[model samples]
Target: MKKLICSLLIALPLTTHASSTLRCDSGLISLQDSTSIVSSKCGEPISREFVGYREVQDEYGFYNEVAVEEWAYGPRNGMFQFLRFEGNRLIKIDSKRGR
Candidate 1:
C-alpha cells in the first residue's frame, strides 16, 4: 500500500503537466515577433522574412528570463517563434505554423 501511494504521488505532477500542454497552432502568432511566439510552443523556425533576433536573460533563483528569435521552415510546415521575456524570465509563449 505504501508503494502504491508513493507511486501515485510521484505520478500526479507528471500527469498534470502532460494534460496542461496545449498543442502547436493553438495560440497567438505574429510575424513581427516570431521568436516569442515559437518559443512558447516549442517551435523551431527554419526561415523568416526578418532573418533573426538576439535574446538575453538574467538569472533569478528558481526562475529565468530568456529571449530567442528564430524561424523554421519545413517541406509543408514552415513556422515562426518569437520569444518573450519577463524581467529576464520567459513566462509566456505563442506560435504560428504554415499549413
Candidate 2:
C-alpha cells in the first residue's frame, strides 16, 4: 500500500507532461511555439499583451468570449517587456507568469 501510494505520487506529474511537447497544427513544438503559433492560426489578437522586458521575443494568443494574448522574450531581458491582449485591450504582459 505504501509503495503504491508513493508510485502514484511520482507518476502523476510525469503523466501530464509524459512528453516535452505541446500540440500544434504542425505537430509538437517547444513550449514557446505552443503560445506563439496560436496567434498566426487564430488571426489578429483581440488585445491582451505582455509587458516588462525590453524586447519582445515571442507572441501568443487565445480567444473565447474575450481574446487573450501574451508576448514573451528572452529571460533577463526584463520582468516581461512582453505584451498581453484581453479582447481588443492591451496590457503589459508578465512573462514570468502566464495564464
**Model 2: lDDT of residue 14:** 28
Q: Taking the tens digit of each residue's C-alpha lDDT, what string does model 1 give over 37-82? A: 5456545544332323444343543443333422332323343232
lDDT of each: 0.37, 0.37
lDDT of 1 at 92: 39
lDDT of 2: 0.37
TM-score of each: 0.24, 0.24
TM-score of 1: 0.24
Instruction: Provide the lowest-lDDT 10-residue window in model 1.
Output: 13-22
lDDT of residue 97 for candidate 1:
46
**lDDT by residue for model 2 over 54-75, one digit each (tens)?**
3333346533454455543322
